[model samples]
Target: MSKIAVIAGSLYLWLSPGLTMGQRTSGLIGVPDTSFTVHSAYSKAKKTHPDIRIAAPALPPTVQANLNVVYCNQNGRDLHIDAFYPVNQSTNRNQLPAVLLIHGGGWRSGDRSQQIPMAQQLATNGYVAVTAEYRLSTEALYPAAVHDLKAAIRWLRTNAREYNIDPDRIAILGCSAGGQLAALLGTTGNRKELEGTSCHTEQSSAVQAIVDVDGVLAFIHPESGEGDDSRSTSAATYWFGASKTEKPKLWHEASALTYVDKSTPPILFLNSSVDRMHAGRDDMIGKLNALGIYSEVHTFADAPHPFWLFHPWFEPTVSYTVNFLNKVFSKK
Candidate 1:
């Protein structure tokens, strides 16, 4: 057998001892590739709000976009980031605050393009906004995606002058899985262990604020319903390369709640009616409150998990995000 096939076979055996070699191989290899895209999300959203439309990806007259700019190069894979900034920002005497937008696809799917419209809107609102591409579970794994995002943050700071960005005033915003990552990044900033040895090591990956849209804050909390494998290996399973029971420490380590401290930056939770999606949010907020840190929560009534992808919700999502960033970053 080829080396890859042999390895895959070993993985099957390791992942599921109960299954026969053939059954395990089929289960492992038959996993379908995720098809999480703007169109797909729109279709899902339209089922409930038929009149809702996908937000326009066009840049506003006052906004300028630099698409597909490579920000990190890892082992020949050039991760790209799309940057949107206000027109004439180059001439501005003051450095503009920036936000990096991360998309959600259960940490396995979705691309930077998913947040293009949000980036454009943020740019129009006078902030330098960037949507980053990170390695997904299919490409790498858990900490790999985290490392890629941190690299993107460092890259932004490294090029802050060129982008007219205030390195210290940056925020990170994400939806769903991306929101979980944004929250984790906010809490784990400057932690040497979580900081991957990727590009821009000299630059810090710390964010001044965080906006998490319907993302869970803990993978192993009592309020969390993650790691349900009754149907099949869950998204978290694929990302962690093991089940919660198999790698409890990994699950706890990835949870943002594990690293919450006084040094953690302000956070905003924009959630939908789906309670499980925002699991552990309240607990984390309570911790922040005890630490005297700033935090806000805005829940959309009866909204879909991917509400940010569609019309009515999209506009409000943008509004809330901008307002929260303004409130948090406006502070010293």
Candidate 2:
């Protein structure tokens, strides 16, 4: 384990030594309702870049889509996935690789439809692409969303034949809060504790590649601006059910940086110019290098934090993801 991992695992242990096992902490603050939709992001971006516009939600003619398919039923709560694939599927062709897209809304406000445009583009590019819905902080707490996403991955693999997808060639991508979850899913692929009870126990939740778009890798790092509740409750605080000061353990445990090891798959970080958005990223890449794992980073300088939601940046985001997925999945 690295220094960051050590800190991540033990940050609050010494501070709360007398706390009992599985003791539920309470009185944690919550944030006001905030919309994290693509429209909201585009509206915010348009303020700075007037010419930038939102990406169209239409799928290309070459793509076939199956929307609102139930991928998991968690205690009767059904989670859905929207799958997109090539329209002209030939029986003789090889099984297509797949990419599962996760939406970012600070783990509170985003929806699966936010990833629809990107999924469409990926499907048009000869891959089985999907957008998944998970239990957000508003609906549940930390590990619930994690388990939900892992279930989505397993669902993709379990139904691989039906979707013409290669069970082993799946990638996960997320923006902002979704990016954090994507990275966590990638790094903790083998950790049984993080795999919450969902459907498809026989299938694996591991992803072959990860694309983290403008998401923080660590919540407790010096570079991280998370948990700052001076003006309002930060999104990280909202998702974790407590402020970083009050529940450092949850903060550490949720960080993707805490779990990165040699077993971690290749990662591609698509970031904005905002340094805080990519907190703990440099250290993460450093660790990946030492572990002999492949990782890539591309910063869109001066771009809005929600660049993936808008026009000019959206195209390159998809392009980088497609290229990276091809390179990493090709090794299999």
Candidate 3:
């Protein structure tokens, strides 16, 4: 194993406590509602060495990065995607599965650069990974970001041959706000209403699978609780352009839970044990089960909402993600 993989494996063992021998043998480190009690230790360690930076592991020799390729032009703005893929490979008929990674910032702030490491890692593992930029709430409203993502997907399919990508095997992955968008994209596949006239109108915007990390499914549900209050207004209120009471239909329409059906793609949810962070997750999982669509949730014990971005948790997060994608794409 690589050095980072060894570190991550050791960290997982250290972080997991109270696990039965059977559970450990099964490699199920996450248990619902089990709080991770090591936050203070990490906090203290950080304070003692405040300048330390936890960089993501480097990609292997087989992977290569293609940065800032414009995928669409919307309202005169050119949206770009940073792609990563394997080089000089004869595996899988010289075509690899693709993943579109979206970053999280509550729809207000965040950039595609936030997901570069993740895209690189996925590429190192033999998939074509693209991190894309979309309009934020500061620039537009609910469907604009969604439209940009759909355009990205269409662009990937349109240029699959150039990138050695399997056009039909693309999946969507996102964190926090991006997670919400990924869920929406997965559920609203080919829905005419959400397919704004950005670009690539003739191509399909559907994804084959979804990976949501700490994203909200039902924005207006009471279980969602309060989110980052530092802003003058709630993120959802800004994104939807109105309070829930003022535009109930808009709220419902923007929710991923509102569109779930038998056609929805397989989904894998990686989340913190905090109930409010993953509000409506269980409800969506139940719906998927009822429809016989595959869905699973793995909750990290007491970890923070941004666990996927940092060390110790990042590796495990990617591990689960790759395993899930492998399972889903193999079935396809």
Candidate 4:
């Protein structure tokens, strides 16, 4: 019907033939109505929503309402993550699902600060939540980021007891570059090279679902029509130390869309109408649908690229994220 929808449908049509190793093409786009009016509605709702209020600061808060902080020194290099468990001061320390969160900053500059607050809120909501920090692109590239997240999952599993967490229920949450890392973990299962620097424990980083916050999907798909190359040298382009044209394979390998398999986790793509990178998220969703894998898309109104973190306290996204996680963890 529309440009974006047409592109999505066309891609679905191409992939409907199933997973065959070959080149498939679909060039269509539908521009849905994304207006500022919707954002105003969200902003208005945020003002009165009870959940919009952020819980106070905490070292590793047991509850978002209080101050309780904790950390882990598991992996070498003082590597660790912050956690928030139930603060009832009553229930056993073993009744919560753990969520591994990654922050986004162009794959080069984010910290757990982006996720800590939300994790703390989740912890308050009867789930054990963690905000982990991993090595950045400056230190490594391509699979390295994925490697670090896998290691974090392993560490959480190995120490689940001490942390009062449920390892099997762990899910990855991230935004932008962090979102890409989460999707990577969700799709790529156990690999020999990414073996987490451990011989004692074998923690499979297969998450139940992925929360992809405005993350890019395919690196190879250029816009169909004539346009400037804003896609070049993008937020994730140079991570491999290879030019876009020189390392075509590397580009595909790093793409989360390239690793979709039967074992890939159900994905929830949170997007906006203003950014092209995220605009292409529908492509990945279409691919997932063709494979019968679980996936959903939530397009934010009027928000532009680089705005997810702009208003960390923005109630609209916060509530939506919480609800999404709850559904992901539901028994149904």
Higher lDDT: candidate 3 or 4?
3
lDDT of candidate 3 at residue 104, scale 0 to 100: 83
Per-residue accuracy of model 3 over 1-332 as CA lDDT, tens digit each: 89999986764554332222122112222222112212332464356445433546777788888898999987567889999888764345757899999988777667787788889889888889999998766555666788889999999889887888887899999998889889999899899988877687888999999999998898778788633335565767666656676666776787799999988999999997667867788899999999999987889886666667666677888999999999999987
Give the range of the ten consecutive residues with the poorest summed lDDT in model 3: 19-28
Model 4: per-residue Cα lDDT over 1-332, one tens digit each? 79999986765453222212232121111121122222343465465442333333454545733222222232233445776667663357444677888877666566765676667767766777778776554444455566667877776777777666666677788877787678777777675644445422466766777888877676666631112237654445435545456666766776777778777777887875545545346777777888888777777775554345435434455576667767877853
lDDT of 1 by residue, 143-215 (tens): 7778889999999899999989999899999999999999999889878977888799999999999999998
Per-candidate Cα lDDT values, in order, are 0.85, 0.84, 0.78, 0.61
Judging by TM-score, tell me the better candidate of 3 and 4. 3
Residue 282 of model 1 has an lDDT of: 90
lDDT for predicted candidate 3 compared with the true structure: 0.78
Superposed Cα deviation of residue 300, candidate 3 (Å): 0.7
Residue by residue across 1-332, what tens digits does model 2's lDDT show? 89997984463342222333243323122332357777777778888899988887687998988999999886556889998899866462699998889998888787888899999999888899999998766555677788889989989889988888898898999999899899999999858988876689788999889999998899999999988999986777766767787778988998999988888999999999899988999999999999999999999999999898887888999899889988998899
Please identify model 2 stretches exceeding 4 Å from their true place.
Answer: 1-34, 90-92
User: All candidates' TM-scores?
Assistant: 0.91, 0.89, 0.82, 0.71
User: Could you tell me how far off, in angstroms, the CA of residue 265 lies in candidate 4 after the best superposition?
Assistant: 1.8
Instruction: Sort every candidate by TM-score, greatest first.
Output: 1, 2, 3, 4
TM-score-wise, the better of 1 and 2 is 1
Report per-prediction Cα RMSD to one decimal: 4.6, 8.4, 15.5, 13.7
Model 2: pairs clashing at backbone N, Cα or C within 3 Å: none
The CA lDDT at 277 in model 1 is 97
Structure candidate 4, residue pairs in collision: 2-30, 3-29, 3-30, 4-29, 4-30, 7-28, 59-69, 60-68, 60-69, 61-68
